[model samples]
Target: MLAQPDARAAAALLALTAAFAAVVALLPWPAGRITLGAAVGAVAGASLLVDLGYPGPYRLPAFWLPFEWLALLGLLFRAVRGLSDRRVGPVGGLLGLAAVLLPLRFSLRTPQGGAAWSVVGVLLSLLPLLGVAGAALYLRVLDARRERAVARARREQRLEVARGLHDFVAHEITGIVLEAQAGQLPDQEPGETAALLRRLEEAGLRALDSMDEMVGALREPGGEGGRDGRSDPPDREERADGATTRRLGLADLPELVTRFGATGAGGTAGVPRATAELAPETAGRLSAEAEATAYAVVLEALTNIRRHAPQATEVTVRVAPGTDGTVELTVTDDGGPSRRPLLRRRPGAGGTGLAGLTARAAAHGGSLTAGPGTPAGWRVSCSLPGR
Candidate 1:
């Protein structure tokens, strides 16, 4: 209901008056004591007229009966409007129903007691009330749908920001961790340690840049930008180094593998060297969404290797055409000793990185799997649909 004091108090007063009148009307008073019944009916009629702003004479003769019912219906309409927007209890609903039916009391005042006229009159009044209530109910339903749509849009935006942070910052941080560990090796030369420090600086800068781009995406009125107002194509975003770059895909894997190999923990010869064997013409065969998801699969697998099996001697990243016009990508590491627990979960089976990539692949009509590879290794692989 409205917050206006008058609206609140009047609705409450009218409801109470309706309940009192109903009790009095139901009582079997002596026929000679007609004044008591008149008093109760007068109270109900006056309250309805005042609350509904009738502003006419409060006469109860047969002539002004129609106006009285009109005022009562106006009260019903207002009640329906208020109740439709609120959480009413069962008692509230029953009281509201009883209040509107008070118009039937008008029949007892007519000469010869026109009970049939009262039934017809009240039934006719209810038809319009039913329509108004239905309309109010429909409007309430539309409001609920609009609220749900807003909630859904907000949820998707949050997920997009979360995925971007996970993909970009995690990759750079993994590189930094590996570089730090490599610099700490006992056999490290001063020159090699200085080079690792430079790489660490670059990785830290890249992570900061990733965060800035994410904030910019949020502040930009619409979405990730292009020269015009239109959105940039998928998986492409502005980088710290420049205005725009293909953040991931077939074209980027060679550089990604190079960086992973360069960050070899404990030094170049001590840790696994990463290699890429990407098929020619595969980029032209895949859609942007599928290609980006493929790139994410490779990035996550490589990062997992750095975290789980830093001592693995051989790391291989391969992408090729699969059966029936599909592109397949795989990353495998020889199950070497790990700095962490030996009983680690397979990267593809369950990890935040791989779990997100699995959803992305499935969205692009593909699937991912991770488990033991041939001849003693852990492998993460996925396939995506191609043109």
Candidate 2:
């Protein structure tokens, strides 16, 4: 009066199990997926060997079910380890497919209690295999996001340090060099005493102070997220930040204007007079990014004028903010002599300054263009989105 087993149910279960296995096999990063696959193979081989040798009364061996569950646990471990690669899924699936056979065989053996029960067993066996694949995929996605975030943070830090070097430290050093050059030497004015020594001492102190701050900024943790984009610790140097009253902006243009005369020129041929025009609204309210970029564009342009256009004079700088929420900065020099060719002995000579500025602009979702100007000059200009 026992129930009759159904072959149709067993066949359907096997088909579903095979489909699941195939889907899992094709996953990427298949390295450790095979571990579960191998364990499944081992279970099938051992089960078949036991069935053949002791075919008498092994219908429901207590040890067989336990081994099967243990194998599934090993499979879960494989999935976790192989999370970074999708390729392991398919191989793992194949192992699970083999495992389904162990349960299928048990169902096919019993007289009245065979196929129907086997189908249920096969479905349960396939559940853990699918679970592992899903877990691996989740881990892979999490790792990828972490990597991207780290890379972005690193790029920002690099821009911060580079900007500090060019905008803060370099600008201060250049001014010191220029002032020292313009000063009368001790030998040139022998009778001059305390005043000249005092000026020299003050200039030296400023240079040293500026350099010490640059080094500290570079070393400080949570790097350079200040108004001026410097790297000091929070609140320690508020006045030192560009947000201070003396921060340079369009308002400082007149003070920045100077006449750069060619070093060896006779009279006026090589001397260039520099001028700046700032739109009335361009000052006081610009963001740190805009002010930094605009200041750098003008500084680099002037530096290049001295370095390459020693024979040409006349430079013009303009700062204008547009109605479309963008600030435009331009620096042009009336055609100076061509920049000197690269000194092959040095690794990077004439290219790094412009490249650094280009990177800085792009990081802020802005653009800078530098090339020969329309009529006869070299132009460096940038447009930055205003916050």
Candidate 3:
């Protein structure tokens, strides 16, 4: 469908052409000036004729000259006006009028009472040309607008895919990194950390899995998914796997906290104490994209706490179930660093992490905000649509 702006622009161009033609036709030139005026007008009108597919009326007999001049002039104005407005209808109609008027003009011009007939003929011929031009312009405008809208939509889809890749895969990979550093994997030999390395490799593979999915979607014919402008049905097996994967929602926050504790064991400062408050199925109900985004937000927050807030003894992960069927996940760390630095450090420190999180949230009709917490430390929170 043609958008409102394109439709209005096309209509305005057509209306202007019609009005200009009407005014020009109503003017009266003296008999002595008629031939010169018609000649000048024809030359000026001919300038616009190239845009038409055929030559305009200047070929009619002497008796029909006056009316032919009017019609040709009107058609020329309509064609030129349409071009100025980026429309095509007027040009097409002008072309048609040229074909009719050129022959009639060559045959009709005479010294007698042909002036009145010329005016009537010109008006009548130009009217149909104007109509044709208006229709062509409208269709062309609609087509151009539709192409632009499709391009914009495709760009948005790519950004969403990038966000999803960064959020889901990055977090899962970070989790594996932390776990490996903490020596949580089963030890196979006396001195070999082969088992831990294997677990880390497994985590890397999982990250790869998410990345592959995103890449597949991006490379798919339509950008997001599918070719030929159609979406495939959700695979039942994939949905089942996704449901199982989403089970690691807020309820698993404690385990994540413990894992952080293990990573921070060597230092004098302890790992931050964190908590989660969320509904049982809130994570599952969220679209795959939204869940991926939420996971990334939480993951980035934890990563920041581990990297920058080493002195912080308590970090809280709170997932509040909002009344409006949304979940607010906040990760607050009690560490020293004013609000300004927290804000400034985000772009420089987090790099693609924060940006990716923001894109992911936006894709799912959500928002992510990060800044300093109330009393002390930093806070990262995301308001995500729930299932």
Candidate 4:
């Protein structure tokens, strides 16, 4: 531009510089669409000047083509990243399309009425854009998949915490309700009311324990308790026999299954045949969260079975080490009549028990699946790392 100090050359240089800067600075912003509109207007004006054969040394775009290339690359990237955000996406699309066209202005020049050269030039100029478009489209698809995965993970985590609360609170609340009903004995015997009050106190205290553990699980890591709320479970000394404070694990599953089966534990006589196949070596290796999750999985499955399939007579609980160093827990039951199907308790503030169990399993970098068994019944199976 300095070699030819004409007014037209100077003016064209100024316009091109401003156009390049505007494209670079404004295309990624909320008001980016305005920038694209201005660029289109500039291109239209430049085309008119060329048609009128405007005499200007700046007619050659050599000084600005590099700037356009850099801006297009940056704009294409922004378009890929911003596609998930509605505010910035449309502007990015328009800018990327415009960027591809800028090169065509120089490359697609054919002599007047030169039909064969014009067709070849147009094809040559447009071919490169297909590659750029393909890359931008692939990146957009990947971004969408990543967003969906993150959303799914968050939803599952919310349900897991809900399950922790539901499982513990439900167990304690069941006890409390039963105790309250027993306390309503019509004829008061000599110390019956006092014994009932003691039972109520125990039930209420268990509920408090459940609340603590669940809240601890919900809290952010390193700010409160360990993962799954109670990473350091109570030792044998801390767990008194027959005490509600007893720490649960694979070892306690037999008693839990028996309790669920016994008629006195709020089920029909001979509710089901409960069996266990827990690995003998799995007494202590599991992290607190994993162990707790395993227990919750079985508890919820049994609860569902008792509620949904009362006539199921055979249940198998298995805990074993997987070949891939994960702990696998499975609870399966033979088909049963749906006794009093509508009588099943409605889900509380937390979701249905299985949803919670699924969350818990996933939290441990494991998974849980409950589906129909080979012959007839249903199976709830899970695999998770110890940590």
Q: Write candidate 2's Cα lDDT for 1-387 as tens digits.
A: 112333444333333334333333343333475544454444444444433332222244323444544454454445444533553555455445555555655534453446667678778867775676567657767777888998988787787666666655554445445434434333445534454356456546755765555555445354344565765342134333233223355555666554223221112243367677888776554566556666776767776655555445567888888667777888887764544321122455456777888877887778899988878778998887776
Model 2 scores a C-alpha lDDT of 0.55
Q: Is candidate 1 or candidate 4 better by TM-score?
A: 1
**C-alpha lDDT score of every prediction, in listed order:** 0.65, 0.55, 0.54, 0.59
Model 4 weakest 10-residue run by lDDT: 235-244
- Candidate 4: segments with Cα more than 4 A from true spot: 1-17, 20-28, 31-60, 84-97, 103-142, 223-247, 254-294, 301-387
lDDT of candidate 4 over 128-224, digit per residue (tens): 5556556777787888899899899878777655665567667656545544544553666778677667756865886787777555544544522
The Cα error of candidate 2 at residue 370, in Å, is 2.6
lDDT of 3 by residue, 336-381 (tens): 3322221124354357777777876887888999998888888998
Model 1 lDDT tens row, 219-308: 635333565656666667654333566656788899889877776643334757789998895767887767777887888888777767
TM-scores of the candidates in the order shown = 0.70, 0.59, 0.55, 0.53
Off by over 4 Å in 2: 1-71, 77-87, 98-115, 162-276, 311-313, 322-326, 335-345, 355-367, 373-376, 385-387
* Pairs in steric clash, model 1: none
For residue 266, give model 3's deviation from the true position in Å.
10
For candidate 3, what's the RMSD?
Answer: 13.5
